[model samples]
Target chain A: MKIAIKLAYRNLLGAGLRTWLNVVVLSFTFVVIIWMKGIMVGWDYQAKTDTSNWQIGGGQYWHQQYDPFDPFTFSESHAQIPETFNENIANGDLEPSLIVAGNIYPQGRMQSIAIIGINPKQNVLLLPTQKLDTFINAIPAIIGLSTAKNLKLKKGDFTTIRWRDSKGMFDASEICIVDLFSCNVPAVEAGKIYIPLAVLQKMTGMENEATILTFRKNKMDQQKVDDWVLKTNEDLTKSIDEMIKTKTFGQSVFYGILLLLSMLAIYDTQVLSIFRRQKEIGTYIALGYTRTQVIGLFTVEGAMYSILAALVSAVYGIPFLMWQAKVGWTLPVDASEFGMAMAQTLYPVYSALLVISTVLFVVLITTVVSYWPSRKIGKMNPTEALRGKIQ
Target chain B: MENHSIIQIQNLTKIFPMGKSDFTALNNVTLAFQQGEFAGLIGPSGSGKTTLLNIIGSLDTPTKGTVEILGHSIGNLSAKQAANLRKEKLGFIFQSYNLLAVHTVYENVEFPLLLLKLNATLRKKMILEALEWVGLTDKVDSKPPQLSGGECQRVAIARAMVKKPVMVLADEPTANLDAANSHHILQTMLKLNQELKTTFLFATHDEKVINYLKRRIYLIDGKIDKDILVDH
Candidate 1:
């Protein structure tokens, strides 16, 4: 095997430009695959981190009647603050949010929105709830940038909000938009408003009541708390995992195409080598190599392309990937528009496992492709091969 | 097998499938080559000289009878065994001087020794000596394409003789060369044969090659027409 490798290296190097061309193409494959995969992995990491920071803080406990997916459930998804969380809430480790279905009239356009009432002093979420701490305001509210844009609302704008109390009595009040903050998570941004928890409880005649409670720490010992259901960080991030899995499957098609292009080059080279180097094959046999050994030599020769390509990719790809990780790759379109947790600029994350697996994948593929064509050597008549005759 | 004979052939036949019919290349031929004999299978084109050489070189097997080289029967040997036999004891030179084109003269000559798994120090020493024998010590770094036809053939000769094989098969080794290059290569082989006591076999109709042979076996229509021993 060592001798085969040595000869294969010499032969490939001596082939000059032809060998380098294949190596360059294969190297391109190596870099592109790693870079693309890195971007997806980075996107996954960033999206989950941002979601945890801006939206689902370590975990959530939702009212049993609450279903974020079902807006109708918002009317009944409310309960008095549980006594078990009172201590944690006092310590600022747990935050309760009262959610109610509401409509905002901004610039004479009515938009249905989810009015979330959070503690203004809460630091568990990245949302700018501190802006709701203002006094002398008719119901101070904070809306995400997307919500503000959709309703043509801005900071210090006055808007009328209408909602139902616990007795099913409709009431309307003029609210002041104190801030329009930016958030990467679209679910937290689109058609959502934040106001002080005391103000919403007082207005709804349900003081000390909350629809959901978010914790700062990930662990929740109680799986069920009275009428509340625990939603762990894993459960909150399950959608992103599913999204990445689907995206990865789609990306695999591109990976296959890229690998196919590179493998085709190797297969073509192997076929041409077999056709053109029949004399060399015969010479190998004449010099004491079995037909199988010659095939192995050819396979090794082909696999060496991947090794060379890896080295070549390291030369340029490492710097490029590092730069990308530092500066990030900004998408041309708005990523938040996808209606999921996404940043406009995503930094690629490359792991050691990813790089090693990619290298092994390409090398294995190249060897198989090379061996596929080199199998013709086994059928060659060495005497005719020694004459340089095509078979 | 005769103790003095390096090759023993008894009623050997080789046939190839030509379309739907079988075309016989060698027919009921019997011959033997003694150790250290510089001999040639002198014949015209299609006279089975190369066919016989191919069989003796273990590149092909006989369809009938047996051909034994250095105690191993060609027809009975497995592919690996035949390869081992060639690797350890046999060397072959081609009509087109089939030197690896991408390799330098030194690398081409060092090829067989590499197969033998010799250490680098001994391989280099033997490679240099073989190159010296072929008067190609100066062209060690020149690739086959960079060298002249005569230089390439000399490299092929060096490659064949580098391991000091028990037998060296030359199939029209001078066919691609001019008279000057042909004689130079043959003289080198003659000197190696006399000095190393290595058996040399040739398959050629070229008068230059036949003239240098101490024993000549003439073939016609796939059978030996004459076997003559000449005192040189």
Candidate 2:
């Protein structure tokens, strides 16, 4: 095997321009696959991190009747805060929030929104709840940038908001939009507004009642209560995981096409090398190489293209990948409409495993493609081959 | 089979399968070679000289009869064994000077020793010595395409002789060279044959090559037509 490698190396280098051309094309495969895969991985990592910080906060306990997808459930989702989590809530390890279906009329235009009541001083979530502390004539409130933009409302704007109490009695009140926050997580930033948990508790006449509990990662293991359902961090981020998984798989198809084209170049070169170097093949046999060894030599020769590509990729890919990691790929403003946790700029993250596995995959496939053509050498008649016969 | 011979063949017949009928490349041929003998399979095209050489070189197996080279039967050796036989004891020279075009002249000559798995120091020593024999020590870095026909053939000779094989087989080794270049190549082989005492076998109709042979075994229509001893 060592001798085969040496000879194959010499043979490939001897081919000069043809060898380098194939190497360059294949290097592109390495860089593109790794770059694209790294982006998906980065997006997955970024999405989860953003979601954790901005909204979910490691885990959640939702009211049994509450469903974020079903706003109608908001009418009955709340119950008294369970006594079991009271200590955690006091220590700021867990944050309890109340949700009420509401509509906001800004400049006589109405927008259906979720009026979420959050603690004015909570660190579990990255929301600017401190902004909810500002005292104003109307109830102080904080809305996300997307919500503010849609309603054409900004900070210091008084907006009329209306909702029902627990008894189904209708009520209306004014809200001072104290601030608008920006975040990568569209779900947290879209169609949602925040107010002081105490203020909403008083206004809704649902005192000491809550709809969901958000806790710091690993701070609370308490998962079950009579009317609450536990959701771990993984559970909250399952959609992002699935989306990235699906995108990665789709990217693999593109990778397959890229690899196939590169492998086709290698396969073509192997076939042509075998075809054109008939006399050389026969010479190898004459010099005491077994047919199997010749086949192995060709396979090694073809697979060496990937090794060369890996080296070539390192020449240019490392700098490009490092630059990309430092400065991320920015998404268009329209990407916010994805309705999931997508950042404005996504930085790719490449692991050793991703690079190594991708290289091995390409080398293995190249070897197979190379061996496919050289197998003909096994059944060749060395005498005719010596004479450069077509067969 | 002769006990004193390194290569012994008896009634060797090789038949190839044409589309509908068999083509007999070698028909009921018998021959032998003692060590250090300068010999040639003297014949024209279609005379089966190359077919006989291929069989003796263990590149092909006989349809019938036995060919024992250095105590190994060509007819019975497996592909690996045949390869070992060729790699270990036999050297072949082709008509068109089939030097590896991509390799430097020195690398071309070093190919066989590499196959032998010799140490680099020893391989380099042997390669230098072989190149010296062909007087190509100066052209070590020049690839085959960069060299002339005569230089190419000399590199091929060095490659063949580098292993110090028990026997060297030449099939029209001088066929591609001009008369002057042909003489130079044949003379190099002659010097190596005498100095190394390696048995030399040639399958050629080239008169220049035939003139240098110590023994000429003529073949025609897949049979030995004449076997003559040249008093050189």
List DockQ for all candidates. 0.92, 0.89
lDDT of 2 by residue, A101-123 (tens): 99889998888889999999999
Best by lDDT: 1
For model 1, what share of native contacts is present? 0.94
Clashing pairs in 1: none
Best by DockQ: 1
lDDT of 1 by residue, A240-356 (tens): 999998998999899899999999999999999999999889999988999999999999999999999999999999999999999999999988688878899999999999999
Error of 2 at A355 (Å): 1.7
Model 1 alpha-carbon drift over 4 Å, by segment: A218-223
- The predictions' CA RMSDs to the true structure, in order, are 1.2, 1.6
Candidate 2: regions farther than 4 A off: none
Clashes in model 2: which pairs? none
* Ten contiguous residues with the weakest lDDT in model 1 chain B: B1-10
